[model samples]
Target: MWVEVLGWIIVIVLFAVGMAGTIYPILPGAVAIYAAFFVYGFMISFSPFGWVFWTLQTLIVALLFIADHAVNAWGVKRFGGSKASIVGSTIGLIIGPFVIPAFGLIIGPFAGAVLGELYARSSLEQSLKVGFGSLVGLFTSVVAKIVLQLLMIVLFIIWLLV
Candidate 1:
């Protein structure tokens, strides 16, 4: 029916946006994708994908959410960043989007980590290293999210076809 076609179109759009969000950090990327799936499943009465698929997707989203933070912290620590640097990076992530928009998200964490290291009385060279580490961590996390998102999409498509 026309309604079903409309639903598919809306879901696809949302999925695309969600995938982009994973890269940009502007939107809840994985969450948005999951929401689309949830809506689709609901519309179809969960007949095919059913509760098991929903549960699997939910777990994937939760794991990715936790991993994002863990990976970032790990990156900072791996680079010998102090506790202050970690705190600074967190603050940068929160404020970057608002301060500089798209690019700010990328720059904010590095700047924040550097500033934090400086505040902790580290040498300038060491602070820069910490900042670089923070940047690396952010990049790693984004890549991980993208891979996971792709897997989710693939699963959705396979389920749809079957």
Candidate 2:
């Protein structure tokens, strides 16, 4: 009983951290949440859900993980970003957490977009727009992840209670 409570606490903490990480680039936000669910499910003996549920959940997680990267690349593509831009934006995202505080996450992607657009079109204004668009795309994904996390939590609760 105590172990189960401890596990729950750990999972909850990870979930919260993942929530913040979803915005920031340093942390593997959705991955952390996905891991938490997998842990919780297995720890609870996979009681309510059968093999099918676990398999489907795992597949969904894999797709979301891939989507995280693909969506950003798509954002850059939409703005006519070059190969360098895509690569640079990825680097910027990595550097973002260290360079800036709260705003770094938001700024890094835009900076990357700017770098990408500049390389592709040689236009500062257009690059800025592309960067902004990428930021919007990232924000949208984060919101979606939050919604999914909430739904997952509710499902877990329902499974446990009923």
Candidate 3:
């Protein structure tokens, strides 16, 4: 009984962190959620997580990786950004939190896109437009990830119960 209680606590906390990770790139949110599932099933009984379920989970992880990059790249391209802009945005994303914790995530991509476009000899106005696109893409990704993570958690709960 005590072991089960402790497991629940760990799983809950990890899930919460995973949800937060969807918005904050600093955390491995999706993986954390997947870990929670693994921990729960392992500590209790792997009977619940069959091979089919594990396969789907693995595919979801892959999808997350593909989506993250695709959305960002699409955003840059749709807004007339070049490869340099994408690279810059990626760099900014990695560096943002470290440089400015409060708003680095928001500012990093925008600034990076702008700088990247400028480097490519784009006009200031064009650079700014690309920055806005980056911002849109960032927010869209965050929302999409949040929904996906929630759905994953709900699915796990269903699997556990049923």
TM-score of each: 0.92, 0.84, 0.95
Better of 2 and 3 by TM-score: 3
Off by over 4 Å in 3: none
Candidate 1's C-alpha runs over 4 A off are none
* Model 1 pairs whose backbones collide: none
Error of 2 at 45 (Å): 3.3
| Model 3, span 1-162: residue lDDT tens | 887888888889889999989778989988998999878976676787787777877777777877787888788889999999998888888789789999999899999999999999999999999998888878877887887788778878887888
Off by over 4 Å in 2: 41-44
lDDT of 2 by residue, 59-145 (tens): 656766777777777777776676777776777777876898877777787898788768776688777767866776677667766
| Residue 84 of model 1, lDDT score | 96
lDDT for model 2, please.
0.72
